[model samples]
Target chain A: MVVLLLTILQGGMAYRQQAIHGLAVTGLSDQITWGLYIGNFTFFVGVAAAAVILIIPAYLFHRREMRRVTLLGECLAVAAVVVALLFVTVDLGQPLRIWHALPFLGKLNFPTSILAWDMVVLTFYLLINILLLWYLLYKKFCHHTLQVKHYFPLIIVAIILGLSIHTVTAFMLSGNPSRPFWHTAILAPRFIASAFAAGAALMIITFQILHRFSRFRLSKGLIREVALIMAFSQFISLFLLGSEFYTALYRHTAQHSSAVLLYWGTTGSEGLTTAIYLALSASLIGVVILMVRSWREHVPLLNLASVLIFFAIWMEKGIGLVVPGFTPTPLGEIAHYSPTTIEIQVTVGIWAVGAMIFTILARITIAIEYGHLKAIK
Target chain B: MANSRSTRRGFLKGTVAIATLTTATLASSSQSDEPTAFADSIASFLQDHYQRMSKDEIGELLARSERRAKREHGVDIKCHNTSAITGVTFGYALNLSKCKGTRRCVEACVTENNCSRNSNMENIRVLSLPEGTRDLNQSDHYYGVEQKVPEAGRWYLPVQCHQCDEPACVQACPVEATWKEADGIVVIDYDWCIGCRNCAVACPYWARHFNWSKPNLPAKEINKNTHYLGNRPRMAGVMEKCTFCIQRTRKGHLPACQEACPTGARVFGNLLDPASEIRYILENKNVFRLKEEQGTQPNFWYYTDV
Candidate 1:
């Protein structure tokens, strides 16, 4: 409770600063306009979209074990979407004028601008997950059985919308033909691959904690199943990373400057050299461990691998991806960016808010599912 | 049930107290730009998009803008909503051989545009390139003024908003706050912009700039003559760029940069007029544009007198 209050206080203070001073308070310039906030926004969008992994197995494959924990996936997505939206809002230069994007009221350039499509898809994804969670939880609370016909369609839509959200976000980044680093055909596939790796890792960790602390009983087999998904996704993510490197490094063209700056340093600017190497190492080690049967079956080792994979993806897909795209600006200026204290405060505050929301939702979910809290007879 | 009710009441009370304290703190700490009249603030807040506004509404908005200049900067300003003149597509051309690496045009543009002084926002950039190379990678953007003008074996390239017919910035704007005018100059409705900076990302030439903070326009420095889409003071958190000196060009005057060139290297005229200098340059001299492969179809051109 105290942490939640502190989060609110700090977040509000930082937001007020952003509101008064505009985006100048952040460490952004004309050279590198989008920074930490956008990075986080992109990462959380992936996380939100990854809920489809559980949805596919639980709903389509009709796996009873996966179905038991699908509620957790939807709840996590809700929190992730909320966090993503907050990042976008805080990053905007004119937060108060956000209504300008509304249809009819303000002119939203749809069909042409990928950003418009991203906004539409993200909103739909959030709403669909919320609706699914509400219906499922309410039914459980009232001791009612769900008819497959009633929700099968909604589940299928959520699954498709989840992919759409991430794909649209990837398109938003790649659509900028001027920025050669992000303007690639492989970006969307790479995003989904990395998202599943990170998302499954996070689920593994969350499931472990819940099983230990509450009446939630997740079998070891279930944990192993999630780890399997993480391993395959991580492998595909590595392959795509290699493909991007080969494409950029082979020709060594002027258009490859962003990748060159990212992997190595240029002149006085070290770029993200050290950070990317560390992420690559973590990714390799985690993938190796997950790929091994004995290591994956071990509970504590599996948990450690999950943590490492999550950190790797966070670093790789977050600042590591975003900052490099802007380093060698389109005009060949090498601009640098480092988030301000206020920016970090606001980011952490939003994460804390997300955690709070997830905890409350998870507690109620557990109570209803376990018959601890329900409608009276 | 009684125990639960009391706990709920206590929780509600705690929330209220926290909420009140937060509001109070925020109110006290924020540097509020509270308008003098409540009704004016409401009207400004609820102002419709520029395209949706009627002529009377635009008039009221211009008056309100003038009033805002008076209140904020203590300047008497005239905000004109000038429409484009028909049968004239404004175009610009620069002679590379005659151009020296003097930034006279840069300073002239800043002074004319009413750009925020604190942000160091300039509409023009003059890059010093070696005599042989056309590669922008080898160009120096921050050419020092301490050196003598036209240093040996160096050529100067002055870049600004090209005002493309198929501008990527216009397409990248999610809120349609920016578009190319009938006269071929791209303009932004600063009030309607949400400042996502997506347009800046989409612009290949780095023409667009954002207001990082409230513009610190001094009354003495403020230009009394301003167009609604050009040279008008902008609020914090909006995008602004070169409008090709729309206020002056629309009034039958040359752009400030064209007037400022010492060697008469800059030329401006209507592209549709065959007798115009810009058209003559296009027909005669070896002309080119930066990033022509991007298909932006920029109206601005660069040529050599050789």
Candidate 2:
């Protein structure tokens, strides 16, 4: 709690400096404009979208065990979305002037701007999850089981929304034809695949912690089922990564230099090469462990695999992906970007806030589920 | 959940306080002669987008900008909202043979556009590439710092905003803060810009620049003439770029770069005019644009004087 407070305080202070002095507080430059904040935003959007990995089987396939734990995934989604939004807020050079993009009051280039679309989809996804959580918690508070008819349509909408929020984000990145590294048709699928891998890994860790520390009697069978999904998604994520690497590095075209620059040192500058290798190594190890049925079912092994998978995806999406896209900038200038102390503090603070939100929401959820917190008539 | 809610609210309140404090600092620092006009600052803060505003609103905004400039730079800048002239489609064609990368155009642009000196945020970048090559990856944007112009077997390509008819920067801007004028110059409403820098990513030419710090325009070097969407003094956090010197071009004056070019290699005139030099060059010369495969339809062209 003290660490969290200190992080927030430091972030708040740094944020003030950033706001007052502008993005100069960041390591971002005219050459490589988007940096640490945007990279994290992209990763978290995937994590948020991963909620559907839980929702799909729970509602669509009618898995009884998954249904009970779907709300936990929704809570995670809510927190992830909040964190994603905060990252964007902190990245903006003029955060207070965001109202300038409001629909009626300001001019939003809606149909044309992929960014505007991303904003809409992300907000809508957040609201949908919030509404779902509220209805479920409210019904639980009133000692009433949920009526399927009331939430059936909402669930369908959320499932589609979950896919879209990340897809739109991918589009936002890929829409920039100028940034050759991000401009790929395969980006959206890659995002979804990686999101599920990371998202399910996070869920496994959270569930294990909950079962160990709290009165929430979550079944091991439920965790094993989630591990299956995580394993499958992680496999797909690795496959996509391999395919992209092969395609980008085969002929080593000029446009594909970003991939080379990311995976290996280029132009006497080793940018994110170490991080990329670390991510790939972790991902491979995690996938191998999770793919084995005997290994995945083991609680300790499952927890280890989850942590590794989560960290790998975070590094892959954050440094390995976003930074390389801008390394040899449009003008062929190799500009280096390393987040300033202010940027790192702000990022850590936002992550802490997200984790705190998830913890509180999970606690309330557990209390309501276990009948420890009941509404008085 | 309730505890988290209060914390979020507290976070917002803190941000608001910080924003107000920063604005107060800006006002105090800029308006030292006059008492701090919080109401005026607030009014400017709540100002409408350039496209949505009435003529009266624009006039008021211009006046405010002038006042801000006078206070900030200690210069009486004539800020105007100059509309594009009718039936004029501006086109530029440069002759590569006669050109030498002297960087006079770059200096002229910075001085004329009131670019940030602290960050060296100039819109134009003169790329020096080896002879007989279109490979941008091999191009050096920061070459010939101390070397003489037109070095042996080296050629210069001065790139700025191409003023595309279908500008990617305009498309990428979430708030429509930027748009192409009737005269074919792509302009940014500095006040309306959210400083997301998506436009910078979208621009193929690396045309757009973000104000990383408060633009440091020395009082003596401040350009007295300014336009709303062109060379006006920008804030600390906004997007600015080459607008083909919209203030000068729309008023029948050559761009600062064109005027400063010693080799007389730059040709700027109406593309629609059949008799104009640019149109004549377009018809006669082996004209091409950078990254033509991107289909940006840039009005700026380059040709070899064969």
- Can you write out model 1's per-residue Cα lDDT over B1-306, one digit (the tens) per residue? 567545544653465456545555555545554323333444565567787676877887788787777787888899998899999999999999989978999888988989888667988888898889877777888879788989998999988999998999999888898988899999999878889999998888889999989988878999889998899888889999999999999999999999999999999999999999888889988899989888889988999888
Q: List the residue pairs that clash in candidate 2.
A: none
Best by lDDT: 2
Model 2: CAPRI class? acceptable
Q: Taking the true A–B contacts (Cα pairs closer than 8 Å), what share appears in each candidate? A: 0.71, 0.79
DockQ score for model 2: 0.46
- Global fold similarity of model 1 (TM-score): 0.93
Question: Per-residue alpha-carbon lDDT of model 1 for A206-273, expressed as tens digits?
Answer: 98788888888888778878889999999999999999999999988888889988887776555467
lDDT accuracy of residue B188 in candidate 1 = 94
Tens-place lDDT digits, model 2, residues A77-106: 999999999999898888878987877666
